[model samples]
Target chain A: MGHYWQEISALTMRWVRRLSREKFSMLFTLVQPMLFWLIFFGNLFQRAADTQVMQAPNYISFLAAGVVVMTVLNNGLAGGVDLLFDKENGFLERLMSTPIHRTSVILSRFIFVMAITSMQVLVILGVAYLFGVQPATGILGVAMILLIGMMFGVGLTAISMAMAFSVKSHGDFFSVLGFLSLPMIFLSSALVPLTAMPGWMSVLAQFNPMTWAIDAVRPLILSGWTEALPHVGMVVLVMIVFDALCLYGGAKAFRRAMG
Target chain B: MDRTIAIDVSHLSKTYDSYRAVDDLSFQVYAGEIFGLLGPNGAGKSTTLRTLITLLHPTSGTATVMGHDTVRDADKVRTLIGYVPQERAIDRFLTGREHLQLLGALYHLTKEEAAKRIAELLKLVELEAHADRPAKTYSGGMKRKLDIACGLLPDPKVLFLDEPTLGLDVQSRLRIWEYVRMLKARGMTIVMTTNYLDEADQLCDRLAIIDGGKIKTLGSPVELKIALGGDIVSLTLKETGRISSLESDLTGRPAIKTVRATPKGLDIRVESPEKALPAILESANRLGCNIEFIQYNRPRLDDVFIAHTGRAITESIPESETV
Candidate 1:
């Protein structure tokens, strides 16, 4: 067990060091979504949007939760590209040939991606504050939002990792990623409220785990604790089921690739 | 020689779908010796080495390293071996020191032990000056040295190097060869694969020449070369088409053991080149085959490869079949 922890920390630290060295990538990854989606898109839609129908004080406040969840989704889904590159470059093979526990490889990647996602979440929230968005439940509400984002991220990261192991090449992984992310974001209550969406799109959004996550977080950011807790419970249940399936699929792919 | 076997492979084969990458190959490496798998690309050299290191399971039969079965006791086998794969494996963002530190941690070395070992290895591979630089900043030779240093982190009983100098320049290749020799001097058993005949001939104590997923021959470099019996007198004729006619004339000569025709000449294998050269020239003269050049030398590893597989090691194998 001690050895396992040592190996995981060592591997995780490698990711941390690599990220720290990539100053340009780190800057863009943190700033891009906040710049385009939260500020520009929020202000653009602010005048056009029906705040009464959407049930929010303003569009920027409403878009804050969406941007937070979307950051998690985007960062989580793209997490496994590094692992896939390792496989292609033969670093994964070298790691497997060592005496360390094989599970350490997967677990370390999860830790690194999640840690980075949490930091990005905090940065996005800090920027949203400048736009006059605040969680109705205050600091505790912010913590709950982070918990929900992480829960949603767990499943997305698993699916990404499974795709990384199962696909023949990075090109194939990216194609599948593009196909999944756009539809998922558009189909969910991410950019728009479910009440405003078309009847058919709303029905599809009901099935999206992203919609459940966004609906849960929107209330905490725009409404108070009373309205947010029940949705939180529902999103938790959805996350449980979603993560179970993704983790099962991910484990199978990992075995096929590593075994 | 202690002669205790370091690795024993018996009827080991690995197949990918219908294509057999390794075909019932078997050989043994004795303790404290450098063993080479000599072959061309796609000859299953890497497959054989990967299996023995417990990276790939054998499709049939078995392999053991230091008395541990490769598949059944893979973890035990891993602790005892180090592998430097054919492809360069390095994190471009990590410094050379960081790479070794990470490997040390993975290998479960204590902080003090890892530090001591990493310092020793950095000096051994002569990378102490460049240890602080990220691998992306290092030259090809430096990256390779870091890779070799990573493999040596555990101070393994056996080291596996697959094409250690595949893409390096001549100076880098020579430097790597020196490091390999230095490792051998410390009494570690090493298994390496290479398509370069000179690498096998000059570096290996014993080698297996593989072709088409099979071991065509196995012996020490000197033994394999000497097994061809006597010397070779190669006569390059000015006229190419009259080789068969001259071949028949020299076939039954008492001094010559065998006559094999090459693209430019006839390679006459003889018990004594002194006695056979005159007879070979006489036959070509009588046959109106004008000799353009004459070369004579003792049998080399390439001749050994030709004698077994009937082709030089440089002949191409289809790219798709390479592992």
Candidate 2:
């Protein structure tokens, strides 16, 4: 068991080390979410909603949770690109030929995604704070934000990895990724509140796991723990089920692809 | 003087949906020998190697490497063997030393052990100078050498090189041959697959000629060549009509072992072409056959393959693709 974790951590550190070496790409990943927050949401929605009615002191605090979730979503979706390229270039075949535990491959990818996602979330949250958006729950709120982001990210990363193994090429993988990422974002409350959307779309948002993650995280950032725990519990439960299903499905798809 | 079997594959067959890639294949590789799975593309050479390395599951049958079943005890089998895939498997973002250290750790080597092994491997492959540079900066031959070094990091008892020199230049290929020889001298068992007849003949201690998912023949290079007898005799006749009678006349002669009809001539396997040629001519003359040209020469691995399979090895494989 100790050795298994050693392999998983070694492989995870490999990705993290690679990520750190690509300074331009690493900066781009964190900067892209901040750009969306500053330009796409901040400038556009500066005076669109009332702070009192929206249940927040300001729009930036409300939007901060969304940016955090979006970072998780983007990182999770992009997580499988490495796996797909590995498969294409035969690196996966080399890794599989070793005596290492098979699940460690998928586990390492998830850990890498969560680590990068956590870093991006910190950068986004720190920028949001500097712009005068403070989480009501303070330091604890950051922990909740990371936990929620990771739970939601793990499931999506699993699905993305499953797609990576099943698809034939990067073209096909990106096509499916493009088709899923935007709709999941728009359908959820990432860029807008569920109440602001049309009735049917709002109901759909209620079922979106991203919505559960954001709704849970929004209160932690804006209204404090008093009103956040119940929603947080529900999101945690939903994420557990989601992670379980995706992990099982991903492992099965991976085994079939190996065959 | 006792040799143990390193790999034992029996009644192995793997079918991809409707196509049977490996069909009822069986063979044994002895410990401490370089074994070659010699075949053209898609002849099931890669399929067999993949199964033994635990990359592909056999549809039916058993493959045991180092006494561990590949399917039932795949992890054990994996621990004993290293595999260099047909395609390059290095991470362009990682340095050659980094790749080695990571792979060594994945194989459960301690950090210090991994570092020492990485250093030794870098030196062994002669990549010590460029070990710190990213693999993307390396040339094709350099990348291939790094790949082999990565495979060897674990000090596995058996190493599988799947067409290790497939696309390499002559110099790089010879360099790889030297590495293989050095590994074998250290008592490591090696299994390699190749379509190049000379690679199999020159590098392997034993070779298996696989075609259409079966082992057509198996032996050392000299044994296989010897199997075709001492020499090959080719006689072209002026009259193609007398081929059958001339073929039968040469068959079962005192010195001629076997006679095969070629498009323009009769090819005979003989103990001594000098002794067999005149008697063959006299018999053919009695049968009203006129010889236009005649040539005698030593047999080659290609001739051995042809004799066993009824067509030249490369001819049976379509020209459009070699895989």
Candidate 3:
């Protein structure tokens, strides 16, 4: 049991070290969401998006939650590219031939991806603060937003990791990633609220776990604890079920690939 | 040499769907000897090593390492073996020191033990000066050395090297051979696979020549060569059409044991080349076969491969599509 955690920590630290060395990827990961989505897109749609419909003082404040969840979504979805590279380069095969616990490989990836997602989420929130968008629920609400983002991230990362193991190559994994992420972002209340969408699109958005996550976090940023708490419970429930399914499928894929 | 067995594989077969990558193969590797699996690509050499290392389970039959079953006691088997695959497995982002540290941790080495071992391996592979640099900056030979260092992190009893010197330059190949020899001197059992005939002849204590997922022959390099009987007299005829006539004429000669026709020549095995040479020349002259070149020397591993498989080891066998 002790060896299990030690192996996980060692593997996790490898990911952290690799990320730290990639100056461009690290800088891009933290800055892209703030520059394009938050500042440019937020200002572009600022006057057009009605504050009353968005249920906030301004579009920037409403878009903060969307950006946070979207960062988590993007980070979570692309989490497995490193593992895929390892598989191709024969690093994973080297790891498997060792005496370490098999589950350590999967668990270490989860821990590393979530840690990076949290850092990105914090950076997005800090940038949104520059736009005069403060969380109405204060520091605890900031914590809750990160919590919700992580909850949403768990299932997405699981699915991504599964695809990393299941697919033949990185190209195949990216194609599936693009197909899943674009439709998911458009279908949710990420860029636009559900009420403003066409009836069919709004109904589809209701089924997106990203919608549940964004809805839960939007209230925390725009409304106080009382309004946000109920939405948090529903999102938490949805994430638990979502994560269970993803993890189950991911385990199966891992077993097949490992064999 | 101690005769205790380190690895025992019996009737081990691994199949992917209908394709049998490893046919019903069996062999044993004794402790503290460098055993070679000599074969071309896709001859099931890598597959066999992977199975013994517990990376792949045998489809049928069984393999044991240090008395632990490969499938059932895989964890125990892993603790006793280290594998250096053909592919370079180093992380481009991590320094040489970091790669060893991480692998040491995974092998469950204590902090101090890992540090000591890592330092030793770095020096052994002569990467101490460049240990702080990421692998991407290292040359191909350096990357391969780091890979070997990682595999040695666990201080395993047996080391499995899959084509260890496969694309290395002559200097790098010699360095790797020195390291492998040094390991064998420490009484570590080593199993390596290679398609290089010279590598097998120079390094292997005993080797199995495999082809099409089967062991065609097995013995020490010298033994396999000497088994072909006397010296080899290679005669390349100027006229290709006269090779068969010359071969037939040379067959009944007194000192000649076997006469095999080659692409451009006839390879004649003679009990004594000194006596057979003159007679062979007479036969060629009688047959009116114009000789382009003639040479005689002791048999080599390539000749042994030819004797067994009816083709030289250097002859390209179309690689199997399945990995």
List per-candidate RMSD values in Å.
Answer: 4.6, 4.4, 4.4
Q: DockQ ranking from best to worst?
A: 2, 3, 1
* Clashing pairs for predicted structure model 2, backbone only: none
lDDT of 2 by residue, B12-128 (tens): 999987778899999999999999998878889999999999989999999999999999899998889998988989888899988998888789988899988888999999999
lDDT of 2 by residue, A102-203 (tens): 888888998889988998888888888788888889898899889999999998898999999999789999999999888988999877788878999999
Residues B203-282, candidate 3, lDDT per residue (tens digit)? 99999998888898898998898687978889888999998888888788798999999999998888877799999989
In candidate 2, which residue ranges exceed 4 Å CA deviation?
A49-53, B1-3, B226-230, B233-268, B272-295, B304-323
Tens-digit lDDT track of model 3 for A171-251: 999999999988999999999999999999999999999999999999898889999999999999999999899989989
* Quality class of the docking in candidate 1, CAPRI style: medium
Model 3 residue A205 CA deviation in Å: 1.7
lDDT of 1 by residue, B1-323 (tens): 46899999999998988899999999999989999999988899988988988878888999999999999999999999998978889999999999999999999999999999999999989999999988999989888998899889989999999999998999999999999999999999999999999999999999999998999999999889868887878889898999989998899889899999999989888887678888887888788999899989898888999999888988887676665
Better DockQ candidate (1, 2): 2
CAPRI level of candidate 2: medium
Per-model TM-score, in order, reads: 0.90, 0.88, 0.89
CA deviation > 4 Å runs, candidate 3: B228-230, B234-294, B306-323
